[model samples]
Target: MGTNTTLKRSLGLWAIVALGLGYMTPTVVFDTFGIVSKQTGGLVPLAYVVGLIVMLFTAISYGKMVKVFPSAGSAYTYTRETMGPRVGFLVGWASLLDYLLLPLVNAVIIRLYMEALLPDASPWIWVIAYVAFVTIVNAVSMRSTSGVNFILVAFTMVLMVVFMILGSIQLYKGMGTGTLFTIQPMFQANMEIAAVLTGATIVCFSFIGFDAITMYTEEAKDINLMPKAIALTVLIGGGIFFAGAYFAQTLFPDVSVFHVVDDTLPEIALYVGGVVFQLIFLSGAFAATVASGLASHASVSRLMYVMGRNGVLPKKLFGYVHPKFRTPLFNVIFVGLVSLLAMGPSLELVSALINFGALIAFSFVNLSVIGYFVFKKKQYQTPKQVFSYVIMPGIGALLTGVLWAHLHADAFIGGVIWVATGIVYMLVMSKIFKRDVTKLGMDAADDLTG
Candidate 1:
C-alpha cells in the first residue's frame, strides 16, 4: 500500500508512457478521430499528422517544464509563473471542472458500451454500480489501483493491436478500389488549408492527455529519466493514436459513409466484426471503458488533494488522507458525489462540457508558453528555436481558442455564467472585508519575491 506522504517513485519511463497511451487509446481516441474521416473524408491521416505535430510542440514545453519545475499541478504552476496568480487561479479552477467532467464522461460512456453488450441492464444501474465499484477500488491504495491499470492497459493494447493489424491488412487488400481504405483519397480529398486546419484542431484534442503523465513526476524514481519517459510517451502515445486513426479509415474505406459525427467506435468495430465477432468487438470496448472510468476517478480526485496542500483552497476538505489505505478518501467520495449530481443532464451535454473545459485549459497552457517565451524571452534561452515554440505554439493557441468558440454555445454560455458568478462572489467577499484584489495581488507578489 502506498502512503500519501511516502509517494512511491517506482514508475519508470515506459510505464509512464503506457499510462498515457492507455488512458488515451481506449475508445476515446477512436470515437474522436473516427469523425475526422467523415468531416475531412479520406484526409483524416493528414489531419492526424498535423495533430501529432501540434502536440509535439506542446510536449516540448511540458518536457522542459518537467525537467525544470515538475509538479503535481500540470498547468496550475505553469500559469502562475508565466502568467499571473489570477490566471493561475483560473487555470486551477478550470482544471477542477475539466478533470471532474472527464470521469463523468467515462462513467456515462461505460454505461452505453456495457449496455450494448448486455442490452437489458439499465444505464443508471450500470453507471452507479460501476462508480461504486471503482470508488471502492480506488479507496484502497495506489499500488493495487496501478496494478489493475497495468493489466487493463495491456489487454486494451492487445485488443487495439489486433484491431490495427486486421484493419490495416483489410484496407490494403481492398486498395485502389475507390474505397475509403484506399490511400488515394487521404491526400486527394479536400486539401484546403482552412479545412485541414479545422480538422487538425479537432484531431489534436484526441492526443491531449499524453502530457498528463508529467504530473506524476513526484512519483517518478529517476529524475534524469524524465526526458526519456516523455520522449517515449510522445512516441508511443502518438503512434497509437495515429495507428488507431489509420485503422479506423481501414475499417470504413468509404470514409464518407462512416458515422463518426455521432461517435461510433464500437459500432465501427461491430461493422468490421460482422455478426460473428460483433459481441467480441464490444467486449473489448466494454472492458476498456470500465477501466477508463476507474482511471478517471483516480486522476481527477488528486487535483483536489494538491490544491488543498498548496493553500490555494481550504486545507480541511482536501487534506484528509485515509490512515490504512492512504488514498485520498475525501477526494474519491467527493468526486463520486459531484459526478452523481452531474448525471443531471443527457450524457452528450456532459461530454461537451468536459471537452470544452479541457481544451480551454490546454489553450491557455500554449498561450502561456508563447507569451512567456515570446514576449518574455528572458525566461527561455532557446532564441534560435523561437520559430518552433513562439510562432508555432502561438498559432496552436490561437487555433485552440477558435475551437473553444466552436464548441456548443450552451457550454460556452454556461462556463461564462459560472465564472461570472464565482467572480462576483470573490468581489463581494473581498469588499466586505475592506480588502481589494490589488492588495491581494501585492501580497502574492511579495511572497514570490520574498
Candidate 2:
C-alpha cells in the first residue's frame, strides 16, 4: 500500500535454490550439447567440468559478497558498495542486458520449439502466449512462482534421469561406444586443450543463473543461508549439465550423427529413445523454458526494483511492490512486454550478447570481494583471512577475466554499445557527476562489521 514497501521474506533455502536452478534451466545441456561437442571434439562433459570449476570460484566470490551486503540488486549492490555508485550503476546497467534479455531468450527458444513441432504455425503466437503466462505467474506471487518453478525443475530432472537410463541401456546393447563406462567421452588421445577451453567458454554461460540467487537475498527468510544457496545452485546445476552431456556424448561419440549441430535437442532425444520419448523430451525442454522465464523474469524485476529504490531509475514505477502480491508488479509487466521482442530477434543474435553482460557482472562481483575486504577493510592480517579475502576472489576475478577474453566479437561490440548508452544515462541522471546517483546512506564498513 505504500511506496516504501519491500518484497516479502517468504523464500527458504530450498525455495531459493529452486528459483536458482530454475533460472539455470538444467535441461539446457541437451539444447547446446551438439554444438559444444563439436567444438570440444566430442568432450562435452569435460568442457562442462572446466566451466563448473570456473563458475565455482565466481560463486565463492558471490557467496562472500552476499554475506556482507544482502540485497536484491546483487552485483550492482556489491559493486556500488565496494567500488562506487558510478561503477555500480554501470555494472547494474550492463547486468540489465543479461537479466532483461534472458526471459526473451527463453521465449525465443519456446517459439523455435513450437515452430519445429508445427511447421506452419505462427511463432509469434507461441512467444506471446509464453510471455503472458510466465509474466502472470510471476506477477501473482513470488511463492507461487517458486512453487511452479520447483515442479518444472523436478519434472525436468526426472526426465533427465530417464534419458540417462535409456542411454545406458543403449550403450550396453553395443551402441555407439558399446560400453556404459569409458574415459573416451571425457578425454580422447589427441584432444587439444585449446579446443576444450573454447567449449568451456560456450558452456560457462549455463552457470549464469547461480549469481541470480543473490538477487533474491532480500526475499530470503534467512539471508545468512545465501552463501550456501549460491554454492549449491552452481554445483547442482553444473552436475546436472555434466551428467546429461556425459550420457549424450557417450551414446553419440561422434558429432556427425546429428543432422543439425546447432540445435541438437530433438535429434539427441530421438536417437537416445524413440518417437514417443522425443516428444516427451521436447515437452521437458518447453518446461525448462517456462521455468527459466519465470525465474529470470522475477529476478530482473527485483533488480530493477532495487535500482528504482536507490533512485538510479524511476522510483515511482520500478520501485513499487504490490501490497497483496508483494511483488514488483510494474517491473514484471515491463519485462513481459520486453519479452515480446522474441518475435523479432533471432535466437543466435540475442544469445550472442548475453555472455558479455554476464561476464561483466561476474568479473565485477569477484572484484567487489577484494575491494570490500582486502582493500577497504584491510583484512589481510593472516593466512585464513588472506585466503578468504584475497586469494579466493582473486582467482575468481582471474577466471572471469579469461572468459571475457574468449567473448565473441559481436558480443563485445554490442555490449560496448549498451554500456556506452548506460554511461550517457548515468551522466544525465547525475547531471555530469554533480551529485550522488544513489540515496542509500549505509557505509560498506558499517554493514560488514555490524
Candidate 3:
C-alpha cells in the first residue's frame, strides 16, 4: 500500500507559541535597541509600539487567512487560493528571501556575539557549528525543535527579566538618565511622524515571526487553535520586545554616547550589573540567536516540502520526508547549504533584503485576507466582518506597503532581481508562460482537502 505522504499533526498551541517566540528571538531587543533608538531619535518604545499596532492588524489578517487555507505553504497557499498561482508563486518567492536568509542573518549575528565573548575563536567555526546544529535539529523533528525552543525562549526571557530588574535598580539608584518611569523614552522633541514611521519600518523586522506560525498549519493538532496561537505569538513577542526596549532605553538613554551602537546591550549589561551579568546576557542572546535560526530553518524546510509536493519545485527532492523522523530532511539540509552564504561576502547587504521581502509578503497576506473574505466568500456585509476583513487588512497592507517602499533602493533593486529571476524560472518551466499555473496549483490545493 502507498503511504499517506501527508504531514502529521503533532503540535499544540504552546509548542506553536514556543516556536514563534523562538523565531522572534525576544533577545533581539538587545541586538537592535540602540539602532532603533538612534532611528527613532531616542523613542525606541514608540517605534515598537507602532510596529506592534501595525503587525497586530497584520497578524489578525494572517489568522483570518489561516482559517480559510491551513497549509504549510502559508503566504504561498493563502495567495494561491485567494489570487492565483502565478502571483502566489511570486509571493512565496519573496517570502523565501526572508525564510532562507533569516538563518544566515541569525548566524552572522551569533558569530558577532560569540566574538565578543570569545575573541580568539574563529567566526567560521561559530557559523558552521550553528548551521550544522540547527540543521540537524530541524532534520530530526519539529517536536525536538519545539523542545529546544521552549528552553531557549525561557532562558532568553529570564535574561530579559533580569535586565529589567537591574535597569529598574539602576534607575532607582540615579544612574544614567536618573528617572524610573518617564515618557522621554517614548517621545522626543521635534519628532515627526515621518521619523517614527521610518523607525517603525525598521522595527517591523522584529515582528516577522508572527506569520511563521501559519507555516505549521498542517502539523498543528487543532486547526482552530492556530488563529489564537498566531495572535498570542504576536502579542507576546511584541510585549517582550517592548519591555526589553523600554528597560534597555532606561538603562542607556543616550544612544550617541555609546562606543558602539551595535554592541550596546552587552555594554549596558556591564554598566547596570557587571562582567558576570554581561556574560549572562550575551550568553542568553547567543542561545536566542541559535533558537531563532533553528525555528526559521524548520519553517522554511516545511515550506519547501509543501512547494515541492505542489510540483513548484522538484517533488522528489523537497517533498521527501525522513521515514523515521517524519521531517523534511532534504529541504532542511538544502537550507543548510544555502546558509553557507553567511560565511560569504556582503552579509549586511544580504541581511538588509530580509525586511523588504518580509514586508512584501505581509502586505500580500493582508490583501489575501481581504481577497478571501470579500472577493471570494462575499462575507463583507456585516460590520464586524467588514472591519476585520476590509478596513483592518487594508490598513495593514497600506502600512506594510509603505514600509516596503521606504526600504533601501538597493533592496528594491534586489527584490526586483529576485522576483525577475523567479519569473524567468517560471517562464522556462512553463515553456514561455504557455502552461496553466492555476490548474497546476489548484490540483495540489485540492490535496489539502484530503
Give all candidates' CA lDDT scores: 0.63, 0.86, 0.82
* lDDT measured at residue 25 in model 1 versus the true structure, 0 to 100: 43
Candidates ranked by lDDT: 2, 3, 1
lDDT of 3 by residue, 49-137 (tens): 98898899889888888877778888888887788888988898889888888888788787777777788977888888889999988
Q: Supply candidate 3's per-residue lDDT for 274.
A: 90
Could you say which candidate leads in lDDT? 2
Task: Judge candidate 1 at residue 194 and give its lDDT.
Answer: 58
What digit string (tens of lDDT, one per residue) describes model 1 on residues 134-188?
7888788766666676677777777787776656555566732424444643576
Whole-model lDDT for model 1 versus the true structure?
A: 0.63
**Per-candidate TM vs. native?**
0.83, 0.95, 0.95
lDDT of 2 by residue, 172-288 (tens): 999888997899988889999888877787777678889888888878999898999998999899989989988888898888988867668888889889899999999998898
Candidate 3 Cα RMSD after full superposition onto the native fold (Å): 2.0
lDDT of 2: 0.86
What ranking of all candidate models by TM-score puts the best one first? 3, 2, 1
Model 3, global lDDT:
0.82
